[model samples]
Target: MQRRTWVPIATGIVALVFFALPSEEPLRGFLPDWVSLVLIYWTFALPARMMVGMAWSVGLVVDIVSFGLPGAYALSKAVLVYLARVLALRVRTYPLWQQTIVVLGLLGIEALILTLIDFIVSGDLSGLQRWTAVVVGALVWPVVYWILRRARHLARLGH
Candidate 1:
């Protein structure tokens, strides 16, 4: 793979390791859905290369690490990446607020998918409690976008 492709893949591997580590609270409570944020940024910044399969693989890794229902996160992330790719042109032109709204909508769908999967596997609705994470994720989208934009700019400069 090219060096540019390796950057996100390496960061993704690190993120997977980070999420796999133990924590005081439940694994779900501590992790900030960093994988989703990274995928979103990469999808916008480099959609020509970051495919849905890549996002799905990262989601599967997350599912394994977090001990949640298998394929739950994978499906959600794949769908999110697909949507981001499809709407990238329109989304790229919008203001930050509009972009944030779009990200929030995507997060909401992801949360619902996870909830449904958890409910299907566990026969309970406890997954609904994790909605806070989605809200926090939505609120943090702008900051993540800014950081990723700057990082991409610097990486290009270094080239």
Candidate 2:
């Protein structure tokens, strides 16, 4: 692994776990996309280092843990990172509310790609769960990004 703060690595791992947890509760169908959300936050915050390959690697780990067509998430995540990388500067410069909207679009695109891949693999579209994740993630981007931002900055200040 490349040299970087453990904060993000830990956050990413936690997000993956959040993704895997059973969402059987009411409205849980719209479990926020913790992994992608964190990835987007890190990508925008540290655009110089969070490259497409990093996204690919994270997706591969996810695929290995999650049961599905391998490379499906890898591709979707890489696409998300690629888009984020392209828009990192302008996106980061925006207000948090505006940035959330941009991230929502990216998350929706990633969801669409993943849903399409799922349909292609299983011949049926996932109902609600996929899109719901996008909506939920987008809705929470600001709070998660804000918390992570503060956490990252605080750690730096402590050191």
Compute the lDDT of residue 49 as modeled in candidate 2: 78
Q: Global lDDT of each model?
A: 0.77, 0.85
Note each model's CA RMSD in angstroms.
3.2, 3.1
TM-score, one value per model: 0.84, 0.90
- Per-residue accuracy of model 1 over 1-159 as CA lDDT, tens digit each: 224545666667766775566667554663457778778878877777778998898888888887877888899999999988987877888999898888878878888888778777877887544677777777888988887777676555232
Weakest lDDT window of 10 consecutive positions for candidate 2: 150-159
* Model 2, span 1-159: residue lDDT tens: 234488788889999998888866786778877889899888888888788999999998888888867899899999999999898989877998899899889999998898889788889875677787787788998789888888678556221
lDDT value for candidate 2? 0.85
- Which candidate tops TM-score? 2
